[model samples]
Target: MKWFFKILALSLILQSFQFSDTNESPDLITSAQLETKKLEIQNYINSFSCSESGGCNYIAFGSKPCGGPKTFLVFSNSVNLVHLQEMVKNYNEMDNLHNIQTNAISDCSVPLPPTEIKCVNGICTIIN
Candidate 1:
């Protein structure tokens, strides 16, 4: 009987913290949005001209790229797409690169472009 009461109390506590999901849309990235994001990235790359004997490293918390520190131009052939999505799982319910939705307002400004963006490598990249 003690165990039963303990279980009931725990259940009630958990239920009190639960929130309704109605009237909210999932903020997952769609194919069309992804394509749009890609185009935006390409445009940023062109504007910065990072490929023409210029090298820059971009950080993507999820698939979205966030610009890190910049250095002098150097020769580099390929762009690195490091998937830091797992590292960003804690922010899954927040906006930007992780692309999740919740009632919580973001404390950090990870610009969700196409929603919000910032200059990375002298180019604008979506915050994720």
Candidate 2:
């Protein structure tokens, strides 16, 4: 009984230690950061999807709906295979980053605080 109580108390102490009140909030991303994020999103779309045979056009941008790629990036007749491959890689990286970051920032931490914070232009406004 004594050992069990000691273990429970230690667990609670450890848990509370994990929660720290930050004196300063995390720096909100700047306008440049937002633009960069948008560009990354676009680049990710362009990269992940590629063209197929028979001059198939398969672009992976905005890939959520899984639309087919287009015939040509440039108006020229032939295609750029090397560029497509690089785009595919870039898309994969961006897709992964977006997913992870989005998941982390979605909703809020546990215990469900009654307040909410909305952010825009690197500023956060708390709302009831």
Candidate 3:
């Protein structure tokens, strides 16, 4: 009975060490959230620049989405096979990057507190 009590006490002590304080906060932000914020800021800056550059034509694809390579339509210049191949490769890369940026949120360590910081114009607003 005495030995059993000692074992139970030992287990409880180890368990206490394993658990962390509930009040403590995490220091990192999920990469997906960070990337999403970054993209938003980039889109905002690009729109400003586009406006300053005498405006540009913005196309809206209703039902269909913009595509590359295979379905590329040759307007005036005849599309080169090599160029098409390169476009396909670039499209794949962009797709992969999009997937990475869209993946489920996971914790990542950052230099500053994630909550207080916001990405503005591809830079952290808290620091600057």
What's the TM-score of every candidate structure? 0.28, 0.28, 0.22
Q: Each candidate's root-mean-square deviation in Å?
A: 14.6, 17.2, 17.9
Identify the runs in model 1 with alpha carbons over 4 angstroms from their true place: 1-23, 50-128
The digit string of per-residue lDDT tens for model 1 on 30-111 reads 5465455545544433544333234444333222223321111111224333222232332221224333322223334353
Whole-model Cα lDDT per candidate? 0.40, 0.41, 0.37
lDDT of 3 by residue, 7-66 (tens): 999999998887678988634345464456545433443433222123222211111112
Candidate number that wins on TM-score, 1 or 3: 1
Better of 2 and 3 by lDDT: 2
Error of 3 at 108 (Å): 19
Which of 1 and 3 is ahead in lDDT?
Answer: 1
For model 2, residues 1-128, the per-residue Cα lDDT tens digits are 99999999999999887766778664443435544754754454334322222222333331121222211122111336566557555554554454454542323322323243333232222344
Ten consecutive residues with minimal summed lDDT in candidate 2?
68-77
| Candidate 1 weakest lDDT stretch, 10 residues | 68-77
